[model samples]
Target: FDQNPLAQMVVVGIKAGIGERNSNLSGNPQDVLKSISDRHKLEPTGEPSLQNSIKMVRDSME
Candidate 1:
């Protein structure tokens, strides 16, 4: 972000043991930070699935 004017970010949260897209691709630092904050508040459950999470992120990006 702030350091990279050309950079954009997307925030994804692991939910139900899988990656869930929480925010759209954005260049705004505030939007990215808020997405992180909101996702962090959730109580985590289930065993994390890295493969599934990666797949979700990849699918969303595509």
Candidate 2:
């Protein structure tokens, strides 16, 4: 995404604590990087719910 100016990206952080949040769709590489860096502050908990995460992603895309 950083290499492609036309590409847009969204980031989702799923924690084992069953928490979820996402960076809204963004085309800026810097914004995407910042979103990831900011989300890294949260320590992961138990196992991530792939099902929940996928649902969240699908909802966000809509």
Best lDDT among the predictions, by candidate number? 1
Task: State residue 44's C-alpha deviation in candidate 1, in Å.
Answer: 0.7
The alpha-carbon deviation from the true structure for residue 31 of candidate 2, after best TM-score superposition, in angstroms, is 0.6
Native-referenced Cα lDDT, model 2: 0.78
Write candidate 1's Cα lDDT for 1-62 as tens digits: 69988998887666567777788899899998998898788888877777887898788767
lDDT of 2 at 54: 79
Off by over 4 Å in 2: 17-19
Clashing pairs in 2: none
TM-score of 2: 0.75
The whole-model lDDT of each prediction reads: 0.82, 0.78
What's the C-alpha lDDT at position 24 in model 2?
A: 70
lDDT of 1 at 20: 76
Candidate 1 segments exceeding 4 Å error: none
